[model samples]
Target chain A: MADPIDFWFDFSSPYGYMMAERIDTLAAKHGREVKWRPFLLGAVFKHTGGQPLPSQPMKGPYSKHDLARSARFLGLPFTMPEAFPVSTHQACRVFYWLESRNPRLAHEFAIGVFHAYFVDGRDISQMDVLEGVAGKLDIAPEAVAGATADDAVKAHLREVCEVAIASGVFGSPFVVIDGEPFWGVDRLPQIERWLEQGGF
Target chain B: MADPIDFWFDFSSPYGYMMAERIDTLAAKHGREVKWRPFLLGAVFKHTGGQPLPSQPMKGPYSKHDLARSARFLGLPFTMPEAFPVSTHQACRVFYWLESRNPRLAHEFAIGVFHAYFVDGRDISQMDVLEGVAGKLDIAPEAVAGATADDAVKAHLREVCEVAIASGVFGSPFVVIDGEPFWGVDRLPQIERWLEQGGF
Candidate 1:
């Protein structure tokens, strides 16, 4: 692996969660390391003209077929999350917390949240729900609380998103390596190609 | 050209106007023929969950960038219509009417509408404005009157949108060469590629 690639993630996005779940294997296939950088989706939407799921008109039909299509394409189970657009404050806090001690655990917790909302139909915005998800990922509740509440961690989240926006970042699950913003999860193959050419 | 490629259009779409103004040049370059199909965007949106230009937040920023970008790209004066999302019923009606008798006149009128909306910012949906534009294109005002009143023309408008939806067409300026749908004006080059290959 050469230089590490940074993946900007938001807790509420199914696409972000999907990228988090599979990026590692995809990165490994190309011989690279992924550094997960969590951010607030609400903040991202403030500056960018995007919708919060229910607002996108094409969402229903596209999402209806997305599951079966995504499953078959990626070889993964994709159930539409019920507790989507969930509050990610606590979940994101846990992510910041776990990243300090166990980045792998943080990654697992994110995957758990994705499955919870889209597949299991659970509201993941609540504190208890987020904590429960952390528990499933074998993370201590205190670690999550500390990580989520830490001013520095919260600042890091804001800083990353601001950086993303300043650089003309439009949507989530985008990775910028060597100044190229790879927009969608579908562009992972293109990302691999860049790293291979030592473009990073 | 082995077959007539469908060029789907709506009045509110600047990109469609841009394509309409210059598609013939592309046709000549690739040795292809085009079949224009005009439809009401309101009907398409009602069926597909699409938003009007003013209603879409992303469109604001995108439109600002697009006007300049398209002008440079297409070598045409790109301008926004004043009374946008203007009723295209009149425009579609005129297209449907002139389609059989004088399609060349219809093409001229389409160019007139594009210049009126994008450059002059005129309201296309208004009958008076349409008649004026028709006059500018040297099309008799009676054609507009006949177009608006004819039941056959109204049915033709409905069929255009119905055919659009059935073909998985999601937006305006959609081009279908053979059975493959090339969406968006940006896909013109790719559309030409298929045309060169005899549309496979």
Candidate 2:
């Protein structure tokens, strides 16, 4: 089997959430495994002078509209959270925590977090919210709390984010296949083409 | 016949150059005409707080790579000019001048300008270059020079740009079909889908 494609995204990104929904199935069809890695886009933005799409002047409103439009276009459920572009640091930590123990469970946990924000339009910022999501995933709220505070898990997430930065990941829905980088969910067609043509 | 699709782009935008090659055929396929409106992105950016893609910190480098990759992926000729992101004010003025008289001639003129900057890597900022491009189309160099200097032509472009901004065109290759706006070349699939399904 070919190596898994590195699919990196921040939990707060709408496009990231959309890509998360489709990437696994798309990769499976191409005989490629996807390593779902959630990282903090906030940290990455610090060095890159990047701001959330909605915070930027004109790009903000257009991006918000595009997000909802793109979701509908893709036939996916989408509802903007009341508080958008929230901090995903804690969510990232929990993802790494769950991922360290069980990759499959982590994937489900990530989906739960995505659903909590994107589908239900619920805020996933507070610990209780994350705990509720983890609880739904069969992960005990106490376990999620305990794992979130673990020094090793925190350090592991920081390390992964650092690596993602060094690897030129500046945006959500960033995909790297065999050292080739593709940013944005729109690159899915190009990704499919790359897999089909074995590099164009 | 339905209203023509509003295809707005700046000559300096790489993605805009790519879209110029495909939008016509795409629109024609659906029995729709395209209103190729070239506006000054820099002027629009002033109101929108948008900088060129290569000016943004991290996104700059990635955009440069993707521009070339996108051209190759689309099987189109692409050569980055030595002086990129050059001022397209004069070129735009010429476009409006030619467009006012003959929209067809203006379309061909726009293609010549795009090819000169993107394929031939020529410095199009010079008046001589503009005259040369016009000469190839059998448009008199003197007439080209006279049209570019026309005060009405200059104001016409400014008016067009203001209209574009009012219509919520925040980026290059922005397409508005039946009152729906789609941004970026990546949204081509969605655009096609929208036209086919009459809105999803």
Q: Identify the candidate with maximal TM-score.
A: 2
Clashing pairs in 1: A80-A118, A81-A117, A81-A118, A82-A117, A93-A148, B79-B118, B81-B117, B82-B121
Q: Summing lDDT over every window of 10 consecutive residues in candidate 2 chain A, give the lowest-scoring window.
A: A53-62
**DockQ, every prediction:** 0.11, 0.72
The model with the greatest lDDT is 2
* Per-model TM-score (chain A alone): 0.83, 0.97
lDDT of 2 by residue, B112-160 (tens): 9999999999888888888888989999988888887899998888899
Q: Which ten residues in a row have the lowest lDDT in candidate 1 chain B?
A: B58-67
Clashes of each: 8, 0
Kindly report the root-mean-square deviation of model 2 from the true structure over all alpha carbons: 1.3
In angstroms, the error of model 2 at B64 is 1.6
**What is the Å distance of residue B98 in model 1 from its true position?**
0.6
Model 2 Cα lDDT, one tens digit per residue, A1-200: 78999999999999999999989988888899999988999889998888888878767888888998899977899999999889887888888888878989889989999999999988888789999999887888889788878899889989999998999999999999988899998998898888887788
Give the Cα lDDT of each candidate: 0.70, 0.89
Q: Who wins the DockQ comparison?
A: 2
The TM-score of predicted model 1 comes to: 0.60
